[model samples]
Target chain A: MTDLLRFRTDAAHEEPAVSLDAFVEGQANASAVRLEAGDDARVLIPYLDRIMLVEIGFPKFRDGRGYSSARILREAGYTGELRAAGDVLVDQIDFMRRCGFDAFAPDAPIDEAVLTRSLERYDYHYQPAADAIVPVWKLRHG
Target chain B: MYKYDQYDQSIVDARVDEFRDQARRRLAGEITEDQFKPLRLKNGLYLQLHAYMLRVAIPYGTLDSRQMRKLAYIARTYDRGYGHFTTRQNIQYNWIKLEEAPDILADLATVEMHAIQTSGESIRNVSSDQYAGASADEIADPRPWAELIRQATTFHPEFSYLPRKFKIAVIASAEDRAAMRLHDIGLRLVANDAGDLGFEVYVGGGMGRTPFIAPLIRAFLPVDHLFSYCEAVLRVWNRTARRDNIHKQRVKILVHQMGAEAFAAAVEAEWQEILPNKSDVPRAEFDRIAAYFTPPAFEAGDREPDRADPDFAVWLDQNVKPHKHPGYAIVNISLKPIGGIPGDASADQIDLMADLAERHSFDELRVTHAQNIVLPHVRKADLYTIWQALVDAGLAESNLDLISDIIACPGLDYCSLANARSIPVAQKIATRFAGRQRDLGELKLKISGCINACGHHHAGHIGILGVDKKGTENYQLLLGGSGAEDASLGKITGPGFSEDGIVDAIERVTDQYIAVRQDGERFLDTYRRVGMDGFKEAIYG
Candidate 1:
């Protein structure tokens, strides 16, 4: 089991995540779901409002499929606890959060001080994404 | 050259700081090499076969004298006294220190430059036509748009981490000088029937294990929808591009497997979803950026250059091109001298080019995709003087588009990825054909160390791919491919050859081309006209 960092005010679910296949096939009654890198997030759109936790597996940090997966779920109105699980590094925290991952579950321990510093390093962004952070372009336009 | 705004400076500054911490952590053993690799690559520091190579972005291949001087300083201070300009219009220092990487980036930041997005899985430098504004045939200057795209793509939140590296090239003219069709996203600025300038977008074209000419996904995309439409394309590619096979992960493979039409349809669907967002930079923002690129005042003078010097006459015809404005010429300073390593520029040469750019060409210079330099706007009257200066500096090579003007990658000599060395092969071939390369006419001889095709052998008219065969270096020759408007992949001729044998084989192929080629037909044209049967027979028979 890995430690989870939750950012939402909603009641957290302690239930184990059902495999994406089981959940998509309606064979599982779980509210928490696990998404492998290859799993399509589009299939879970109908059940997004009901899901309390959605864990995206990053088998390797270099394999960036989970970033897109997290973005797709958030854009599709999956307001659940989007967690980035496995191989998550301190440097990738900011990008994962920008892609709508509000929770992190690293396979290895990350230094909290370094993670915090990295996250707060930049106040300006080039483009708007799954996050509410206003792009610098918007500031100029306004 | 686009100057960095407050937002731009902040982002770059923050990145340098982040990289500084990461480097420190690595030094302290807090991060492993596997973890440190991506972080270092994102900042353009690569641990190569011998040392760390730092690739600094020359955005859209455009840089001013100050930036060039800074690059010279970095080359002298950080590594050796030289740097290699890549085919992607970026510069790489061969012997960089990991400890000095952060300091180099900090130094780059002072000149409003950083290596952000120059490497890693995200977007590399957004390359464009080296002769952007000065070229006679361009519809509009492509650099402004390239700059806009550069800013938006720089440290882009969702796209910082991608399945594979993405490359974008923008061009505005009918003549594809920038290899527009050979990028992951190739944007050619065009005007519609309504006269509104937009782009004819091509996606998934790349040169690697599998070379492709990116299909036309959109015939005309309005300038307003540039980012949203791009987002759709990237998003689709991000989620759908194959991650299973490292070789098959480029967006080109996805487009190939899905078929062009189906890929376009998918992008269209995604575009519709994101259209309401209006993610592209506003008109005011574009105008602000465009203001930086507006050409300075020019004095009208004699259009015809004095051609009394025969050597000057040859160079004027070969190296000088007609600029958009009368009396102005686009000067191509070929880095390829006879027996010199392709793309290797000494600190002295870099500083000289900078001085020439400042004095003769409005303080602006461009690094060509073919590993040359261009002073985009020089008065025709100053041609003789400029030519004399280049001659003095050993920069006057009258071989633009000629056989001796080779494009070779730093192969086994520097790159860990290479199977065989490419520099010696290029030197041997160039030396062999030095006397007759001019007669050959427009032969794009490219070399790659391996199938990754950094040398762009796939797109070369006479291409060579170097590979490892049973612990020895082997070379493969290819023909009939081009990276121009009519882009096509080269086909392998026959059996591989040894280093010396490949050079001899090229001679035979070129000799055959001379015999069979019609009047005014170049190597590629002859290859296309007569087909591969003749060339293969010449090589084998």
Candidate 2:
């Protein structure tokens, strides 16, 4: 990460909903959990109820196992807050949202204006994600 | 051909500016060779064995006369008075100075052309059939969609940092002339029974150290969903493709390990979640792009002349093809000459072709995957004049799709990955088969420097694979291969041959075919009719 970009975390606002640095690993954690169909309800139910934030690891930028983990958690009714951690970049924020990440912790500082501009860069939408946004086709044709 | 809009022009201009800055920094010693290496590559500048080679992108193999003339100017000014058209539908100048490279790029930008992303891990040039808009057998013109895909994928944020290089090709015809099946992702334009336009998507087919033909992921994907589907595919690949071993980083390896079914499932799942998002291609946008590729106004006439002038007839039989328009024909300009470098066009020849393209053709030129140039739309009446000009320029040889019209990679002479020199082998074979052109009919001789198959030797009717043998060069011969309608990989016949022995071995194989073929049967057809047994026996015997 020699040419890496960094962003500072805001610690003044009541610890916030999700910390950019935390790495979540439990079965109930949206970003790092891997669950089987037959997991015990006792363990799953309690963990699902208690966890409020989850951190997704990229491991390497290409290794997207964490994206699936986040999506599965979102589908499984975990609605607290989702944040991306390791190897995050400005370019991946749109995809991160589609995979159920609500907040991103890109290695570079968050340029709110730039981020806002990028969020609306392309008006067309596709794929069913946590955002449930309407694709451009539906807006025009439907 | 798709014309460049403001966005396309701006992008090229910006890229030239960026490369100029990088060149300046490198000259000033602000960056080390290692640091500047990838940066230069991303801008399509390669430090080859001799000098810096600059590869200029000809998107989807389509270019107008203006761009072609500009290429000629660059060739005359910055290069060794010649340029090589590569298998990727790009042109490479072998002798480019670091100082002059930026100026050349600036000149190219004037005609809305620049050599960006022609090399490097980023999305390389998107290639399509050279006969894209005019081929008679094509279902629809694939250029507009190819252009859309090119625009969407260029400098795409999520895909810029992939595990390895990625390539995508689109074919709109029944025959895969562009060899789309051998790319990272192959898109075949097709119309469903319901008359809906869509694509048959193939994933992970590529030629490299590890060669794999792409596998089908979807039977039919609607045209509007093109971007979204492609996005889903890249996301899955970017996430799961191997990273540790550079050799195993291509999407093909991942697709192989995951199996096409599992890979398709992963893509579907990702698509399901993202289909509701903001990246899908809109129908209007598709129309906007497609409108640019509409066929030019054609005058109706009998394509066949009363008696077909002998020379024109010979050229038509070999070089001209049936165009979508009845009166027009697609003219394939063969770059391969007997004992000459495949794909090399001198500045004078380039300028001559450009002038002819403007006067007789539709002012358009295309670079084919087989290392040749093409004039996509030429009128039947202008055939003789065009042929005469081509002959005067030393371009007309009436050897299109012939043995001497070989496809060869720039082997040890240029490539860092080559084990043997490919150009010399190509030269030897071409010379051996020269003057005997009438004897050797409709045979494709393709040679690759290494197994990476840059020259597509595996798909040739007579395939030549160059390998290093105990610090010496050797060539292996493969027969019964086809890159067209019935595409199949060639299988090795027997033991490898030394450089001197390879030409003789190829001669033997051709002689076997000449003896065994039915009247007027193609080499590939003959090989298929009587399997490799006969050809193998002749070679090994």
Candidate 3:
């Protein structure tokens, strides 16, 4: 396994990710799964407790379906490591983090200083998401 | 106009800081242009023909004297002496710098303004009726709701990077002044049988290469479900909209493919799922926002407006409309001057208009979808003084809704995407029809430099689209379209014509209308009554 950003406490998985069909076939032993942009995240919700890591693919950075995919999995109570892999950039880090991406495996390596600056930039957010950041509206009203 | 609170202020301030950093990095060659383009575009900065064009959001077409004055300051300091108000009711500065763009946004932040989401493939600005609060025809003011939509959509986590740009419009009237049906999502505030207010939601209406009138998705959605319902709509489109073909990515195309019935059903199912989780705006928070838009204390104004001057009388006849309050009137300010740019407002003119708003209009002003301005709450007695001020400022044009009042895009002269110049064509058409403008009456002529339809040529009563024909510029004329309650797409009259020939072609169409029109019929009415058959014959022959 190549170097990847991880927020999870456990050691990184050594096994290669299996396809969604393969994971569903071996749900009892399957610990890592991969989802393409077109795969439905809802189908894996029942087996989320057994899975330790889920890698979602993005063929291009401009295709935003991966954000929706990450959000759907996290909001459905997936506590395992959610890794965003392929064609990601420093700019999308802030949004990907907000959408519950705990790990990143970009096709191109990102600069650590720029990544830190992007993630720590905004203290407030406009909308509630899968992340722990309270939406600006809640703070205002309270 | 809604004022930004401390929360709003902090968010805007943070955005300015973030943009400043991004601009610094882009300038220092840390990121490539392909990477920096989408980020700058989200903040309303665009690379145009000669310079970077910056589009500043005028939320729901509403702003105050203070905000308006700040706009003038930005125009004078950062840009050329003028800014162009767009058909979407936002203002565009054509000559912006990549370096100074961040400073411009910082300056706008001081006046409770930012250029966020004015462009790019995310949700763009939320527009509403210019006459939202003051008009008699509306069920209620739509500004508060527009502001809510504005806030919720800003920096939305999941739907931030849409396949194509999304536009949402909110209106509370039967008379459609904001081109509500031409947006990606349109909401009309209405009343149920129980007399409770809600929205009639329309999804998938837009114009570009393909023009569609949004179909009704919900007849009456409850008022409290505003955020949840909209979230459902956005999520459905975001997840399912085609990413393969950029042209077929808009929600309108998706709606057509899925069929309106199936699309609405999908939205309803998503909305039902969202309802159990409960993410709608709180009633108290909604009421808190609504309090800002309450009516100002209005004294009984003079019943009669002085019309001793013929120019004032003509201006009053065309530019003024009855407000809900009998004492006041809604005054439409014409940005279009014959033989000039349709929507260009100079620094001096902008300042003067701001002063007028401060003095006589409860400090409020609105930018209309027709690229005009409106002092929504004005005393009828102060009409003469305002007219004189406008006359001195070269803005007292008595051609409201007339042929000279054209809606045009900043075409090849400024925009990088344009195939021909829309402004020069608009200037020529306005000047040619100046003498007979009042006689022809209420011709909503619109021009676009390309098929992108930024000028809303698809909705014009007399639509002119400028196309690139081989190596030369060409223009096509279409007849019989309306963007009102009687909305219909226009039909092309004939083959293309030269730049000069199109102006003459327009005149011939009007001449035919005058010859065969019935009593009290406007140009649109005339065109609608007699279809494109006769107009095509006259123009083509």
Error of 1 at B211 (Å): 1.0
DockQ per model, Cα: 0.73, 0.13, 0.66
Descending-DockQ candidate ranking: 1, 3, 2
TM-score of chain B of each: 0.99, 0.96, 0.99
TM-score, model 2, chain B versus true chain B: 0.96
Q: Could you give candidate 3's per-residue lDDT for residues B1-541 as a string of tens digits?
A: 6888888998899899889989999999998899899999999999998999999999999999999999999999999889999888899999998989989999999999999999999899999899988999999999989988899898887877888999999999999998888889999999998999999999999989899999999999998999889988888888888899989999999999999999999999988866764668788778889999999989875587877888899999999998999889999999998888999999999999999999999999999989999999998888888989999999999888888899998899988999989999999999899988889978899999999989889999999999999979999998877788787888888798899999999988999999998999988888877888767788887
Instruction: Report the alpha-carbon TM-score of model 1 versus the true structure.
Output: 0.98
Name model 2 segments beyond 4 Å from true.
Answer: A1-142, B29-32, B303-309
Residue runs of model 1 more than 4 Å from their true location after superposition: A9-11, A27-29
Q: Of the candidates shown, which would achieve the greatest DockQ relative to the real structure?
A: 1
Query: Model 1 - which docking category?
Result: medium
TM-score, cand. 2 vs. native: 0.84
lDDT, residue B242, candidate 1:
79
Of the pair 2 and 3, which is ahead by TM-score? 3
Task: Give the C-alpha lDDT of model 1.
Answer: 0.90
* Error at A102, model 1, angstroms: 1.1
Q: Name the 10 consecutive residues with the lowest summed lDDT in model 3 chain B.
A: B273-282
Residues B26-100 of candidate 1: C-alpha lDDT, one tens digit per residue: 999999998999998988889899999899999999999999999999989987899998899999999988888
Q: B33-145 in candidate 2: lDDT tens per residue?
A: 76577667877888888888899988998888899988988988888789999989999998899998889889988987877778877778899989888887889889988
